[model samples]
Target: MRGILAGWDSLDPALRWLMRINLIALTTATLLLASAYLLGFRHTSVEIDLGVMAVSIVLMLVTPPLCRRYGAPAAIVGLTLSALIFAVGGTWATPNLSPLTALLTMVPLLVGFAYLGRRWIQVLSVVAVAGSAGVAALAEWRRTEAVSEEWWINAVVIAASLPAGVAVVVLLVRSAYARLQGQSDELVESRRRVVEVADAARRSLERDLHDGAQQRLLASSVTIERARKELRAGRHDSAAALLDQLAADNREIVTELRELARGIYPPLLTERGLVAALQSTARRSAVPVTLDVADVERTDPQVEAAAYFCILEALTNAAKHSGAAEVHVTLRGRPHLSFTVCDDGRGFDRGAVDAGGLLGMEARVAAAGGRLTLDTGPGRGTVVRGEFAP
Candidate 1:
């Protein structure tokens, strides 16, 4: 069943066309059977019945595709009418068990109607019931022989079984379709959130590069130029002091650039793996951070990177905003990797923080198919937790 569904999903436009062709062929073949029965074998009114059956089959096959493409309700009406025509035509000629075949034809129609949704399903049901009743009455009127007790019981059995079978199939198909739609909706929502986070992260990086690193580099360049001019003017003491200050400023700028680059993408995550990198991050945090990592070897690189960044961002946020004295970082690397960063701070409202660093952290996590959650409120220290599957 899984393979069949997968194959159906893999089909291109041409294959869909082939499916429509096959539906037409099946309808034509059913009509041919009815014609052969009435004309070739039973020797009933041949030309009119054949023409009617052909028209009904053509309507059945042609109308569905049109309705499927254009007007769905009209297509459903076409299918229902096609079934009724077959039922009434069979009843008029055979009058023995023709209504049974007509009811049986409604099974696929019901399934299609259910798949389409409630409005169509209701329309199809009303048509099927009314059509079947009309066919049964026509069959009763057209009977040449007297109706027997056994025939009534058989008719009742056929009538009951056909609709029941159709109902079951329709309900089952409807349930399965609903489940698929729900899963599709969930996937769409997840992707939308991921896109939002990534866009915010890009904007934040642009701001950081423009406002922080760019300005620092500019200041360092100005200091070096001033030092050079002082040295050329034969002011050795002032030049030496200026040069020393320039060197110090350049070093600070370099450090800030490195830190900014790391924030963009950490090299430690790729080199040393998640555990060592997270440990280093925890150790470097401003507040006292307790680090705990278990079964580090099992962690995948992408998972490791996401976990590391989430911790770094959370710790950075804690230091900058939380006014926290202490923080804790923990990692569990079994079943699925999980990380938590908790700080003891004068916590602000999580809702009030605009999506900047936190949003970047979320993007990184989501890119690896993970989730980041922040828990903080007034007087409540923040706890940022993230989880990723392998």
Candidate 2:
């Protein structure tokens, strides 16, 4: 059973539905037919009816592989053609009108409409409605005394067709709406995180300036006063040395400010795009880093920032926390921006994976409208993979 379902997770929505609907419809239809036979529903060709169903079931079984190989549209057309054949064949095999068989005709059209494009949906809707009316008209012309009791088959089919189409549209619209709502919530969450992180960044910047560059500047001012007095008193050599020291201090302050600015947002990430920026990071990393980056077209700065920071954070973990030697970083573009950071680090147990750094990484990815996943096990190493359409 496990082997049977091994590739099920990767199946597309249409293919998965094809499998599920086939199983469920086969089961339920079989039971309904057996019940109808026991209840003495007249059948002119029971063997032929069963033969059609048998052939359809065989075709249905082949659809999954075809769906996997050829994709959704062709598989859907195959499944629908099979259904259309069975419906016509089965109804003709019955003496009066197989009301059940007539109803089953709409299943293919509606399911196809759900999976196919808007044009296909429009085509299937017309086909279903016209087919319903035609089936009813056939029953009307063939209304003999034995079949007189099912004279309402036309009304039933017409009524069922309209409602079924409407129901499918309603369901599809609702699903699309729910997805939009989920996206809206994500945006709100992202906004909240940006606000909080921005506020924290401001405070951190203030503290760094006061503790680092500000004190150096104040000391330099006093040195300038002493240098002026020495020069005024004809101690030119000492004054010149003091001026030289002050010049070095000014250069150091400029370097410190640049580093602080880089911490907020790297200049390379904006100027050269993600791949170049990542290469820069790799060169600077203490751990031996190997990069497998494809040529990337520049994307949104925010998106590039997220990818940069995530990989940067991952590298930080590698250097400071993880007892690791080497790290591999991969990046791809075109279809969308994606990257992976893998480290030969001592991974933690899955149960104890609730570290703040990990949580921050996840939140950062989410804020950028992307998905991120972490794969790790103790002694197995850690992989942080992320993807987003920018």
Candidate 3:
């Protein structure tokens, strides 16, 4: 059963809906036909109705395989043509079933045009439904069948056009509801990821302060107390040497704090612009870098910051992971702020990318209303690019 319906989930909602309708109708017809002898229905011939049912089941069953092998366009064309044949053929096969088939056939007609958007196919599908309804109405005008057997056929055939329109409305509501649901789910997940990344960064900053600047400040306080004790005992040389060491320690602490702060957000980014900040980053990279940044005017601070950080992360990744000798960095100003970092490194498999590095960059870019993409493969080098909105 799973194999039979393997590709069904990939079909468009409208296509799936048409398939469900056909399945239900086929099941109902099967049951009705089973008891037709008792009801004295299908007494004219079982063979014709049986053949029609068999052909329809076969056509419907083949749709999923075609969807997998040829994709939606081919599958849609085949399914729509089958529906057209079913519509016109049912009217000729049995005037009784024509109204139901004509009404249902409009399902594909409306859905097909909305999805496929081909004018010629639209005209052909429209003609099929209208033509089937016309054929049924003409048969009603000069009918020789028993009046009891044909009580409601013509009324339904006349009303087929209205029901077709209603089906379009029904599908429109369903499509809209589904779209909203999908977007809502994505929004929730995106927010959750942003919060998670922010929490992780906060923890990292706390750890850095505790290990680097905070630890150095505590040690310096101890040294200052020792120097005071030496001065109180009138040991001038000892106190002076201790004071010099304390000054050195203080300088180291200041440098450590500034470096840590730079990791969070660069001071140069605000002072000069994105181009100057990026050049500083390129100079600091472990691998050789060829920087080519456009001297374009700055836009949104947030947009510039996102592009800056993504390039920084990409350069870090290339240095740490890809053993590349040289990296090329590019920034564009026109249309919108964008940047690319390409390295002639021995790239790793994309499937094995570090989620923390790449995902964090992606989230940061998304937060700033931009996009990030990576192009890489083993032994093929790596390229990371980001583009911001105009």
Question: What is the lDDT of every predicted structure here?
Answer: 0.63, 0.67, 0.69
Using all chains and alpha carbons, the TM-scores for the candidates as numbered come to: 0.51, 0.57, 0.52
**Candidate 1, residues 1-390: lDDT per residue as tens digits?**
233223222222222333344344435544555545544433333333455457665765555335322333444455556556656655664466554645644543544542355666666666667766776777777665523334543343234333433443345456557756965775776577677777877888899888987887788788788878988898889989988887787788788888888777778778878777777777777888898777657456777777777788788878888899998888876435778888999888657767666766776786776778888889989888887633
Using lDDT as the measure, name the better of candidate 1 and candidate 3.
3
User: Can you tell me which runs of candidate 2 are displaced by over 4 Å?
Assistant: 1-188, 347-360, 376-381
Candidate 1, residue 213: how far the Cα is off, in Å: 2.7
| RMSD after CA superposition, every candidate | 16.6, 7.7, 13.3
Q: Which stretches of candidate 1 lie over 4 Å from their true place?
A: 1-183, 355-363
Question: Across residues 27-84, which tens digit of lDDT does each residue of candidate 2 receive?
Answer: 4544455455455643434445556666776666565554433445555566666566
Q: Model 1: clashing residue pairs?
A: none
lDDT of 2: 0.67
lDDT of 3 at 132: 62
lDDT of 2 at 88: 63
